[model samples]
Target: MVTEYESALEVAERLNRLTPGEFEKRTGLFSTGAEAVENAVKIARTWTGRDAIVVLGHAYHGRTLLTMTMTGKNVPYKEGFGPFAPEVYRVPSPYPYRWAGAATTETGIAEEAFEQLVDQITTQVGTANVAAIIVEPVQGEGGFIVLPEGYMTKVAQFAKENGIVFIADEIQAGLARTGDLFAVDHEGVVPDIVLTAKALAAGMPLSAVTGRAEIMDSVRAGGLGGTYAGNPVACAAAIAALDVIVDEDLPGRARHIEEVVMPRLKELQAECAAIGDVRGRGAMLAMEFVVPGTRTPDPDAAKKVAAHANARGVLTLTAGTYSNVIRLLPPLVISDDLLEDALDVLAEATRTLA
Candidate 1:
């Protein structure tokens, strides 16, 4: 563990440099992503004078008691975890690929449907009682479901009009992993608050909630932090990670991964009846396995493919509430040859499963 004074100074310096805006003073560091999100909710509640923190369906914020309540999936993440936190509502995510209609214009349908849902939520949840609405710019554990075009902007407008603080959970999609410093940047939408971790420190335990000045300051100073809120080692790693991402142009590298992976995955979809959808942005992508020629999920097939990939020296993770989707989170530092090799392994796995 890092000494308290040393950690404080390191965090102070880093936050001063990275969050030049008013956030430098308002935002507090946390030992883990879960803690950061927990405090973000606390701050939002205090700022809005509201009761509940609204979450979207298939969202995976964290695993702490409060966060486990916000996660949309059940089974393993919540089976033994009883009685989660209260006032956290889950709504359907903007999943265009599996949306009810067969229209190729998914972005349009998604924009309309999800916005309508948001309107309904605010009405029922009572705008006056709604503290905040948290969502992943790119739904991570929910299957790397990138929102349809204009989806987030419309949602942000809805949240703003309803006086609900919009929180962008960028834990899995930020820090050049999605070909941008932040995934929310892609839509040109500036959320009221942003949550990030994962690759922020290249695998270290650190997360942050940077946001509007007043909202962040709503909580009392001592109410927002932890003993090791910003460990020196993790901060050092984060600073290094930021340098590597900028100097080596990891955002461009992420784009390269998407360009190569998406096309090949699309080919698999055309060839195999069991391949349902290929989606996501940059290096953060996923392909859902389905029952042959149908949208019905097939976790068994996904499991088989994952096992095959592991045997072949490639690692992959499964996601989505149904666990039938394969999510690819290759190290942004992986070589082009290695990236291609992994994709090749995945392609062959798909063929075998098909």
Candidate 2:
């Protein structure tokens, strides 16, 4: 067993506080989101004695070997990274914006997507060999594609029925990013394992895999550890940061950000046909750029819009498999005035192209 530090214990306690008595909570701290994600997969594989893992299209887990293999995008993340780890499978992403204006709501589209995934699993990868179904409640690097209502619940139920460990890769959406402590909370879905990082420690290099006792403890002694996994300084920072999340009501702040910014984004979308879609919740939001009057992705427009926003002191990121999505990831703590100011700049930028 790895020697436990006091701060690490405190950090675990703080994280557990979010789900009091929900499960026998055990957390393994790591220095990066990739490490936490990879460890969670390891735990799932060990506990279930299975090998295959499932991920959704447009998903972005991380850059490590196993995590990158789990990721669904190619190009910068997986290109030339070759001979990747095996046993990772892909599913259709319920991305409504790009669903070709199908005769379905987001919920309907999600049902179809899951059905396709089930078919693939049954045919391509034996269902019994599946170890986990990992998802980000909101796709981040994949352009903040929020899962439709009931989609996460459906996935959770499937995992339960199949005895598959369900993981919420909340590294980007948890900790009040979506106006909820965890994005899955909005869907009332409780994953077997939740990987957290990014905002967890107020920017400190700390990530964690918190899960059920049985699965976490199933690993043999010495199965999980790193020389700097749970560095005391980072753990201490995480503790304080978690406190701030509670004391300052960061979750509520996130909601406030959504309330203040979402309408403005929608209004901006009304004025620009190039804005193929505007989505996301709380401080994490996005706008997908497409050719005017068509859904064909326009990476040039996305790049130009981001450049314009950046020139005006509003930072943005281009995302998605086609890189035609400009994602808005403003700080949750941004004041209403500042957030609006940034949005105003973005609005002007979009209009310049409109």
> How accurate locally, in lDDT, is each candidate?
0.81, 0.88
lDDT (Cα, tens digit) per residue for candidate 1, span 1-354? 234556545554554444323333444667777887898899889999998888877888889999989998897788889878988877667788776644457676676667656676767776678899888988888888888778788888888898898898888888788888778878888788877677777888887777887787777756766777777788788778778887898889999889888899999889888878888899998989899867889999889999999999999989988999999998888888888899899999989987
Indicate which candidate wins on lDDT: 2
- Evaluated at residue 279, the lDDT of candidate 2 is 94
Alpha carbon lDDT of residue 130, candidate 1? 85
Question: Which 10-residue window in model 1 sums to the lowest lDDT?
Answer: 15-24
**Residue lDDT tens for model 2, 1-354:** 167899998888777668423877898899999999999999999999999999998899999899889888888999999899989999888888876435379878888877877889889998899999999999998988998888888888989999899999999999998998888888889889999998888899999999988999999988998888888988888888888888999889988988888898889889999988989987788888999898898999999999999998898889988899998878877887898899889989999999
C-alpha RMSD (angstroms) for model 1:
2.5
Which is the leading candidate under TM-score?
2
- Model 1 regions more than 4 Å off: 1-25, 101-104
Indicate the worst ten consecutive residues by lDDT in candidate 2.
14-23
Against the true structure, what is each candidate's TM-score?
Answer: 0.93, 0.97
The lDDT, on a scale of 0 to 1, for candidate 1 is 0.81
Error of 2 at 133 (Å): 0.7
| Model 2: pairs clashing at backbone N, Cα or C within 3 Å | none
